[model samples]
Structures are given as structure tokens and as C-alpha cells.
Target chain A: MNEELKHYNDRAENLILNHLESGNVSKMIKDASIYSIQAGGKRFRPYLVFATLKSFGLDPAAGLSAAGAIEMIHTYSLIHDDLPAMDDDNYRRGQLTNHKVHGEAVAILAGDNLLTESFNVLAEDESLPADIRIQLVQVVSRAAGQSGMIGGQMLDIEAEGKNITMDELVMIHRHKTGKLIVAPIESAAIIAAADDETKALLLRFAEYLGILFQIRDDILDVEGDMSVTGKLSGSDARKEKVTYVSTYGLNGAKEQLELLKDDAEEILENLSSKLDTDELYSVLQMFAVREQ
Target chain B: MNEELKHYNDRAENLILNHLESGNVSKMIKDASIYSIQAGGKRFRPYLVFATLKSFGLDPAAGLSAAGAIEMIHTYSLIHDDLPAMDDDNYRRGQLTNHKVHGEAVAILAGDNLLTESFNVLAEDESLPADIRIQLVQVVSRAAGQSGMIGGQMLDIEAEGKNITMDELVMIHRHKTGKLIVAPIESAAIIAAADDETKALLLRFAEYLGILFQIRDDILDVEGDMSVTGKLSGSDARKEKVTYVSTYGLNGAKEQLELLKDDAEEILENLSSKLDTDELYSVLQMFAVREQ
Candidate 1:
């Protein structure tokens, strides 16, 4: 990852943790929210928002709340996805699950609280331009709703251990994980009032990054250790889930990631807007090849 | 419930059910959403909204979506509340629990869909006045968030085994159950442009109904039949959870409901703006003395 992008990643994570800490939840709920959120997955999605919004020279402060809100929503989704009835995973970030610590009910409610808090942060704030705020709200509602993350989830649930085509798998991952991962950048572009060409390049940039990330995730599921993954090793193997690595073989998956990384880099290079997304783009390049 | 209220109750329910069914989802999710929402409940709150808006000579069409949104939100809460981690009951309104039918994960997600859909139903449309939409959005948000339903839920969670004071129980029920139950009417009042005096009386009317409704619920838990309830009989009794009937005894709970019902009736009868909440208030009165 580029040094500048890494710095912003840390900045976004710390801000989310700090803001989330200040919210009023039951002590148990607060602690549970912090535990899963602070478990520290990559914050690339939020950093895309902060970096892209700032690439236009807007003060990062102007968008930090939205950045934090997006991350919270992301973290909440991860928590629920890791629940027993969902992914049935026992570890995250190489640690015990939220439900393992707090029990199922509290974990569920904590996720609920975080998801609900995302909108509260957006809607209650009066400092942002109302039109921009409304735009953000629309972006978020669609990105998170049934046609987006939830629909992707439906596909994932239906595809496991089943004969699913590559297109179906791509569709599932795109919505399930790609939507949120890409949303930050596209939303940032919209908020920054980027031109159509710039927006399209950014969208391409996000798609490449999202697919590369998912492919790497599938690879890790095959070979990554529990300690490194903070999750069970060979989880996809156990679920017999069809994945990029499973369908295309590890070598094919690696080649796919390389192709996506090059595409992302090319888009960043071609953008007319003089922006620091190159640093973010470089980070995706590193992410495509790096071990956890 | 009064005969007039029953007519509108049917209308309000059919309207929401149709809107809900129009959404694209798996049969399981659709059934779960409908399962929790389609059953009988006194739609007093919705009636109050339409009546208040109509009485103020505001457009009733402006209130329809909000009315539907409130009922869905209410039904979602009931579904979650009946889950094993919350109330753990197997029945509601003499029907099988949502979790029992759909399993817990789908039930939980169905609740989430309803909540998300509620906001989308408001924000995505241009039917309601922008200002009223914004204001209604804030009302529903606050009512469902930490300081409202969640806060009330936290109290209920904490108060489960304690020496329960009446004030504490009232506070829990008021915030947990009352905010949502009361919000529909207040939302109507806001949209209807009801004067402050009338709004105050409507809130009072809702307040009485919410409290009286809880008391009746407690009384029903004690005497309500297993066949009708579909719940394992005496589940609440086994836990010895705090309730109006538990604290006040049956006769005391009944008397309290009567007094509260009378107070609510007086508020409506004396409403200065000549707002008509009579039919709705009558439902509250019948529900107060209802045998389930």
C-alpha cells in the first residue's frame, strides 16, 4: 500500500472508533460494537471516500462523519455475515467471534445499532448542504438495500455447494462485497461533483479493485492460515463454496487479480483530474498480491 | 375497537400488505415479512393519523405512506421482540412466532428489511411535501433510535429479574413500546398541520393508549389461552417478568386501563381544533378490556 493511503486508512479507522465510542449504547452494546469494529479489517473503502473527496481539495473534515458512518455500516455487515447462521465462522481478525464473546442476541443488536446509527449520523447533521446530504442518503440507501448488499447476500446463500456459473458468482460478490467497497469512491466522486468522464474512470477503478479484492479473498480462503486470516483455514473448502480460486484454480485466480490490478492502475493513470487516487490505486496493486 | 375504526383498519392493513408484496424478495423473506405484519391488530394509531389529517383538512394521500411505514415498523419490532433472545415467546396475536415459522436469521433480516424499507418508502418518493417528509424522517428516526425504542429495549433487558419499580416499568414501556405506537399519530399531526393544542391532546391520547395497551397485554399473558396464543402457555409466568398484571394484579391492571382509557377519551372529546380521533380511541378502549 502507498504510504499516504495507509496513513489515511489509519486516520479513518481511528476516527470511526473514536466517534463510535462517543455514541450512547448500553455498555454491553457499546463494547460489542467496538470489539468487532476495532478488530481491524482493511479500511480501504472509507479511505477511498476520504481520499477522493479530498482529491478535489475539499477539507477531509467536511466528509469525515460520512466516512465514519460508511465504515460502521461496513463493520456491522461483517459482524452479521460472520454470525453462525450466516457464514457460521468462529474467528475474525484471528480472534474469537463477537457472538463467542457477547452471545448471539447482543451481537445481533449491536449490528443493528451500528447500521441504524449510520443514517442518524447523516440525517441529524445540519452542517452539510441539504442537497448533498440528500444525495448521500440516496446513495447509501440503494447501496445497502435489497438490490445491493442484501441481494448479493441472497445469491451467496443460494450458490454455496451448488453449480453456479461464473457470471452468477461475479454478480454475488459484486453486490455482497463489491458494492460497499466501491461505494465510497463513487459517492466521493458524486459529492466532489466530478465530471462524467472522471466519474466513469473512478467507477472503473472501483470495480477493478473490488474484483481483485474478492479474488484475493478466495485465494486466502484456500491457503491462508487461521492466525493470518483471523478465521478458519480452508473455510471455502469446508463450505464447498464455488469461488474464483475453486473455479479457475489458484494460478488462474492470481492471473485474474493481476489483470484487474493493471486495469485499475490504467484507469487511475488515464483520469484527467489531477488527483492522489494514484496512491490509492497503488495500494490496490499491493493488496492484489500481498499476504495478510 | 369501534366499527368505523375497523373499516379503516382493514384498509390500512391491505394497503401496507400490497406495498410490501410488491417488493422483490425470496418467497421465504416475503412470507416472513407478511407473517409478522399481515395479522390482526387494532390499527388505532393509523386511524388517528388519517382522522387527524383529514380533520385538519390536509390531504389524506400525504399521510398514506407514512401510515404504512409506521405499521411495518411496529410489526418488525414485534417479530424481533418474540425472538428467543428477546421475549422468547412463540406466539403473538394468537399466531405462530415469526422466528418459529421462518427461522431466526430470516426473521431478523425481515425485520431489518422492513426498517430499511420504511425510510425508502418515504425518501425515495416525491408524494409527500419535502418539508413534511424531512420532518417525518426525523420523527421516525428518533423514535426508533437509541433515545427511543432502543433505549426502552435496553431498560427492558436490564430490568428482567430486578425488583421492578412501577416508574421504571412505565419508563420502559413508554419508550420501548410507546414511541412507535405513539409516533404514527404524531406524524399525522405534523403532516396534517394540526395546531399545538390539538397535537398535545393527540400525544396525550396516544400516551394513554400505549400505557393502557401494555397493561392489557400483561393481563392477557396471565389469562390468554395456549391454543389461541400459539405460545407455550405461561412462558411469561415462568420467567415471572414484570408486568402491570404482575405488579398491580388483574383487578388493579384492569382499573388502571379503565382510568387511562377515560383520560384518553376526555382528551379527544375536548380537542379544541375539533380533530376527530374518536373511532381510533374506541379501539384503544376495546383493546384495553379485550380478552385474547
Candidate 2:
């Protein structure tokens, strides 16, 4: 990662950890909930939240709780996604998955707790106006709920071992991953009280970035090795899952990824005054040619 | 059920079915999501939401969306709680559970969709004030999430087959069931813009009613037969789960139920000017002497 992105990631991680630890709940489930998030991964979603806030020349501090809230939602999805009834993955991010370590029942509850606690955190965030907090809850729930990530997941599961169309593939990624990636940017807009035009611009920028991120992920799944990626290479192919790489092949996928990167850069350039385009550009560059 | 409560129940059911059927989504998972909620349960929680609103002299129509949202959350919990990894029950309310009918993955997704959709419905409620809608999302999330129902569920799972105290049992039930029960009443208060003092009184009233409801459930679990209850008797015992009956015995549980009922009646009496205590009292009486 670039230096600025790394800084945002580190900051986000610290803020999220502090917030999770300070949650008022009984010890046992609290510990399990904390444990679910403590398994460190790139704090990418949260980074976007703070990054968007910073772009608006606002203090990112107020956005941290919301950032953490998004991460909590993201983490809960992963925990549930890794359940025995779902992907059944025993490992994630080079460690035992939540259900493996916490037991399936506790893991499920932990996921439930994290998902529930996320709204509590957002709702109780005193820094933002009540209206803004309400908007955050409203928008975030839509992105994380049926019409977004979870819906995408259901589609993904059903699409297994099938010949899915390009449109279907795009729909899957858009709902599954794109909506959440867009959530933080939209959340930042809500918090900053950005105008509709700016919100649209930010959303457009996020859409490009989301597609780019996923296509690169598909590319990496094919090309990246286990030692560096910390996960199995070609697993998507092994599962016969249709992805950007599966549909367009490596060269086409790379070409599409470049197009998305350029698209994001163009949007960022247009909104240069309203946002910190330089930081976003660098992040885009990283994802555009990421090796792992 | 009595005439008024029965009327509210039917209204809640109709509103919820219309709302669920009207949701715009892709076909397959949407159907599954609808299926999860179409089981024709008693619509008790939604009834409380409308009944509470009616007591406050507000049109129950204003509360329909919020009432439906609460039922969505409740149905989602039942779907997840019946997962093979959880309680693993095949039948609920004399019908196959969501997983049993729709397969595990879809069941899980249906639960996720309902939970997420509940928030969406609340956030978009046109009848209520924006602030009230937001408050509903916050409070409902807390009640349904980790610190409330989900937390209690974890505690219940951990306490299985263990000797537990009355305090522990109460704690579990309060968190698991009581909070969600209290949520609808609290929501009515928010929508009605009741004073803090009134809110406190109603919450106290709800707390007593919640405990009473749970104690009655425990009593029915032991004493009521399948023909009346539409569920297995002694199932709690078969699971070796601790309950009010298990902790206090049959006679003591009945005595405790009486105390809670009296307590609720007293609070209801104090708030008669602000609410329709006659209806509240009748509901309490029904719960107190309910055979199923």
C-alpha cells in the first residue's frame, strides 16, 4: 500500500479496536465479538470512510465510529459467510476462521452481535447530528442488507457450477462487494452533508473503484500464489465460480481493470477541489496493478 | 385472544403480508424471504406495536410499517435460531422452519434479508417523524442485537445442561426475549413523543409484561399439550434447557407470573390517561391465564 493509504489503514484499525473494546456488553460475547474483528485484515472499508471525510477537509475523528461500524458489518458478513453451512472455510487471512476457533454457535452469535452492535454504535454516535446518524443507518443498512451484499452472496451461491452471463457476473459483484465499498463513500457524503451532485460524483468514483477492486481480486486469484496472498490461488476456478477472470480471461480482465482505473481517475480529477484526489489516485494505482 | 386483540392481530398480519409481498427484489431469494415470514404465526409482536399505538389515541395505520418491521426482525430470529447449528428445530408453529423448507443457505439468506429489510422499512417510514424513525432503528437494533436478544441467546446456549440460578435464568430471558418485547412499546413512546417520565412508566410496564410473557411460555412448555399450544410440550426439558419453571418449579413459576401481572396492571393503571389501560389489562389477563 501507498504511504497515505497505509496511514489511513493504521488509523482506522486503531480507532476500530478502541471502539470495539469499549463496547458495553457482558464479557463473554464481547470477547468473541472483539475476537472476530481482531483477526486483522486490511481495513479497506474504514479507510474509505476516513479518506472521504478527509477529502472534505473535515476531521476524520467523527467518522471513525461510523467507519468502525461499517467494518463491524463487513466482519459480521465474513463470519457468517465462513460458517459450516456457507463457504465452510476453516481459514481466513492466514488464521483459523471465527467459527473454527469460537465454535459454530458462538461464531454465529458473535456475527449476530457484531451486526447488531454496528447499528448501536452508529445510532449512538453523538458527534454527528441525529439526522445524519439516521441517514447513515438507513444507507448502511441498505448496502449491507438484501439488496446489496447479502443478496449478492445468495446469487453467488446459486451461480456456482453454472454458466452465468456477463450481466449476471456484474450484478453479483456489484451487489456483493460494490455496494459495501460504496457505502463508506456515501456515508462520508452523508456525514459531510455533501450536495447531491457531489454525492453522485463520489458514488461514481466509488463504483469504478469497487469494480476495479473486484476485477483485480479475480485476476489475483488466478495469478497470485499462496505464500504472498495468504489464501489459495485459483480457488474461484476450483469451485467453478464465474468471475471477471473466468468470463473475460486474464488479458481481457486486465484490460477491463485498466479501464476502471482510468474511469475512477477521471471522476477524481473532476472533483479535485471537493476531495483529496491525490490520495484516491494512489489507492487506485495500488489496486490497479496489485500483485497480492 | 379477545376481540380487540384479535382484530389488531388480523390487521397486523394483513399489513405485514402486503408489505412483504410488495418488496422489490430479484425473484428467487425474494420468494425465499417472503416464504420465511409467510408462516402465519399469531403476529403477536406486531399486534403489540399497533395496540400500543391505539392506546395512545394514534391511528394504528401510522404504526403499520414499524409494526411490520418488528415482525420481520422476529421472524428472522426464528429462522436463524432454528438453523441446524443453532436449535436445529424442523418445525415452528406447526410448519417446517425456513431451512427445512428452503434449504440452509437460502434460509440463512432469508433471515439476513428480513433482518436488513426490517431496518430499511423503519428508515423509510413516511408516517413517522424522521427522528422517531431513526430512534426506532437504533432501539430495535439494540433490542434485537447482541446486547439484547442475541446476547441472551448466547447465554442460553452456554447455560445448556448446567445448573443455573434464578438470577441467571431471568437474565437470559430478559435479554433474549424481554428486550424485543419492550422494543415495540418503547417505539410507540418515541412515535407518540411521550415524556421521559411516561416513557419510564411504559418501559416498567413492558418489563413486567415481558417477564410475565416468558413465565407463561415456560409454564405452557411444561403443562400445555400439543393440541392447544401447537408445539411440543416438554421440549424444553428434552433439550435440558433452564427456564423459569426449571428454576422456580411449576408452583413458584405460576406465583411469579401473578406478581408480574399485578405489577404490569399497576403501571398500566397509572398511565390510563395517556393510554388505553383497559386493552393493556386484557392482554395481561390473557397472558396470565393463557393455556397456550
Candidate 3:
């Protein structure tokens, strides 16, 4: 891992851990919330917030709250998505899923807590101007809410056992997975008070990175081994679920991933003069070719 | 309903309806979101927003978005609370629950959408100063998050079929249902930018109102007929749920309720010099005796 990226990840984990315990909520809820978030992932979303801030030459601390907020939103979505009534997955991050470990009701409430906590964390951040923090709330809410991730999840649910076109598939991933991926970058830019042009460039970078990440996920679902990925191989296909790989063959999906990677690199290159790109590019490279 | 209260309710319904439609999300998610919000209740949260604004002599329109936001949050909680994994309720507000009307997955997403949309609506509201809007988000998030309503729910869920002390029951109700009920009134005060003294008084009023409301709800659960309350009588008792009525006994609980009502009315009286109390008192009186 990039040392800077690793540092940010550690900071994010700490921020989230500390914030979860700062409240006087019941022990059970606080534990459930902590447990769910502690069930770790790649910390991709928070990394974006930090990397974006670094790119703007701002201290990564300025983006920590938003970073933690986005990650909380991501964790909450995953917790809910893995519910018995939703995906019913028994494992996540190579461990028993939230509902599988905590009873279904606890898991549901846990997700709700994380979601609600994300906003509270951001709203309470003293690092940013109150106005910017509010903007972060708005952006994060839109991305995490019905118009973005939740809406996509609904469509994904509705798409199950049904044939969906390529457009529908793109729409789902863009919302279900894409919006959250984009949120932290936007939030960081808002916090950094980056110029409109710079913010635009960051957004473009995030958009391509989001699609590329989903494409890689779909590809991995088909091509990777379960032992390496911690995910059941061919689960999407087994469920008869549509994906970029399902819509376009594995080869085509891989080809698209490469194209998006190039596009992202080009955007970063375009903004290389405006901000540091090495750390951002390194993080992007790490996510781009991960086995898991 | 009082004619003024009815006007605010209708306006709230319209704002929610329009906002849901304005989004470009899938028809399925949109419909699910709309269905839950349109399930039809007393719109008490939104009413509090308007009533608070009215008491401050501000145009009710100034409270519209915050009203809509609180209603959306309330609706989302209800949707999620009724899920099969949670309360497994099949009916809400005398109509089929969201999960029952839609699939469990859709219902979950719909609730999520409402929650996310609530922030968006508030963030996007042009009526209030940006700083006040941000304050609204902060206050609402805390009240709704793990420390407040969601945390309360965790306690409520854990308390089911178990013996609990009076203090524990009060804590559960205060967090589970009290925080949200208190949110709108606080939000309106923020919007009105009332003095610290006034805000403190409103918070006190809200605390009393919250306890009063939950006691009434518990009383209704025990004494209310389904035909009038749109809920099953003794359902809480049958579930072995701990409630004010169960913990205090009906007479004791009723006494407490009267005491809280008096406290609330007194606070309103104290604030009458700073803000009009007629509409506020009218609304409180209506809720005080509400059977449903």
C-alpha cells in the first residue's frame, strides 16, 4: 500500500472507531454499529477523500470526517444489502455478515445506525466551515439516498430474475456502487475549496474510477478464485444476475476496464499540474488490478 | 384538524409528492418511496415544524422543507420499523405496510430513500439561510441516529418479552420515539433563530411532549380499539413488550401523562410572551387527546 494511503486508512479506522463510541447510545447498538464498521474492507471510499485532499495540497485531516462518513455510508449499505430479505449473503470481508452474526433485527438497526451516524459525524465536524459541512451532508445524502445508491439497490432487486439491458445494468452500478465512490471525492473537493475546474476534473476521475471498480468487481466475480477474493465465484451468474460481464463478455468487460483506467489516468494527467497525482494514481493503480 | 393545521398538512403532502416525482430514480423505487410517505398519518412531525414557525410569527412556508424533511424521516423509520425482520408489521396507518405492499427489499430501499431524501430536501431548501439549514441537519441527525431514535429502537427491540424497570422503559421510549418527535420543534426553533432561552424552553416542551406522546401511545396500545386507533389492542401486552402502561400500570401512566401535559402547557405559557401560543397550544391539545 502507498504509505500515505495506509496512514489515511489508519486514521479513518480510528476516526470511525472513536466516533462510534463517542455517543451515549445503548451498548448493544453501539457494539453492533462498531462491529459492522470494524468488519473491514479495502477502505476505498475514505481513501478517495484523503487522496483528493492530498491532491489539493490540503491536510488529509480536513477530509477525515467526510472520509469516515462516506465509509460509514458504504458499510451501512453493505450491511443492509446482505440482509436475509436483501442479498442474504452469509459472509462479508471474509467474516460472517452482520445479520448472520447479530440477529436480523440487530443487523437492520445496525445499518440504520451507521447511516444516521454518518450524517451526524459530518454535521458535527469542526474541521470544515459549517456551510461546507452542510454541503457535504447534502452531497453524501444524495449519493447514499434513493436517487443514488438506495435507488440503484431497489432497481437491482427489481432486476433480479429478469433480463435487464446494458443501460439498466450501467444505471444500477452507477447508483448502487458508483454514487458512493464519487461522493467522497466530491466532498473532499468541497472541503478543500478546490476551483470549479479542479473539482470537475476530480469528479471525472471519480466517475471513471467508479465504473472501472464495478467492472473489475464483475470480472473478478467471474474469473477470480473464491480463496483469493473471499467471494463466491460466479455468484452473479449463478443468481442469473446481470452485470457488465454478463452484458458484455468477460473479455469485453476487461477491455472496458482497461479503457476506463486509461481515461482515469488521462484525467489525472490533465490535472497533474494543478495538484499532486502520484499518490492518487498509486491508489487508483492498487484498486484497478486487485485480485479481490 | 384545525383549518391552519390542515393547510400545512396538505402543503407537506404536496412538497413530498413533488420531490419524490422530481427525482430521476426508477419508477419502482419512486413508487415505493411515494407509497410509504403517502400511507397517510396525522403528519404530526411536519405539523410541529409549522406550528413552531407559526408561534414565532414566521410564515409557515419558511418551515416547509424542514417539515417535509422531518415527515420523510418519520415515514422512513415507520417503513423500516414495519419490516419483516424488525416488527414484521403487515399494517401501518390502517394500510398495508411498505414491505407488504412492496417486497421486503423494495420497502427497505424505500425507507432508505426517504431518509436520504430528507437530507437532500433540507440541504436543497432555498427558504432558509444555508447555516440554519446545516444546523437543522446536525440536530436532526443526532435526534434520529444511534444516540436517539435508532438507539432507542435497539433498546425497545431488546426489551421485548423481558422484564424492564420503569427507568429503562422511559429511556427506551425517550430515545426510540421521543427524539424524532422532538426534532421538528427544535428544527423550527433553529429556523426561527429563537434566543437560547426560547430554544431551551422549546426543548423542555419537546421533552415533555415526547414523554406525553409515548405514554398516550402505550395507553392506546392497551385501551384503544382497533376500529378507532387503527392498531391492534393489547398487541404490546401480547408481545410482552415493556411500555409506560405496562411498567407504571394504566392509572400510574395516565397520571404521568397528565403531569407531562401540564408541564408542556406551562412551558408554552412561559413562551407566549416571546411567541404566539394559540396555534401551538391548539396542536398540543389535539395530540394530547388523540386516540390514534
Which numbered prediction scores highest in lDDT against the true structure? Answer: 3
lDDT of each: 0.72, 0.81, 0.86
DockQ preference between candidates 2 and 3, better one: 3
lDDT of 1 by residue, A41-124 (tens): 767666778767766777655666567778888887877787776776788776788888887767777777677667666666
- Per-residue CA lDDT of model 3 for A25-143, tens digit only, reads 68888888889878778888888888888888888888889999899989988888999888888988788998888899899888888888888888888767878988898899989
Candidate 1 vs candidate 2: the TM-score winner is 2
Q: Any idea how many clashes model 1 has?
A: 1
Per-residue error for B270 in candidate 1, Å, reads 6.7
Better of 2 and 3 by lDDT: 3
Predicted structure 2, TM vs. truth: 0.94
Residue lDDT tens for model 2, A115-216:
777877888777777788878888888898777888788888888778989898888889899999999989989999998888999999898888998998
Order by DockQ, highest first: 3, 2, 1
Candidate 3 versus truth, CA RMSD in Å, comes to 1.8
Candidate 3 docking class: medium
In terms of TM-score, the best-performing candidate is: 3
Query: Tens digit of lDDT per residue, candidate 1, span B84-202?
Result: 87778886767788888877777777777677666666566566665666567667766776556766777677776788888888988998888887888789887877778878888
For each candidate, the DockQ is 0.37, 0.60, 0.77
> Candidate 1, residue B23: CA error in Å?
4.9
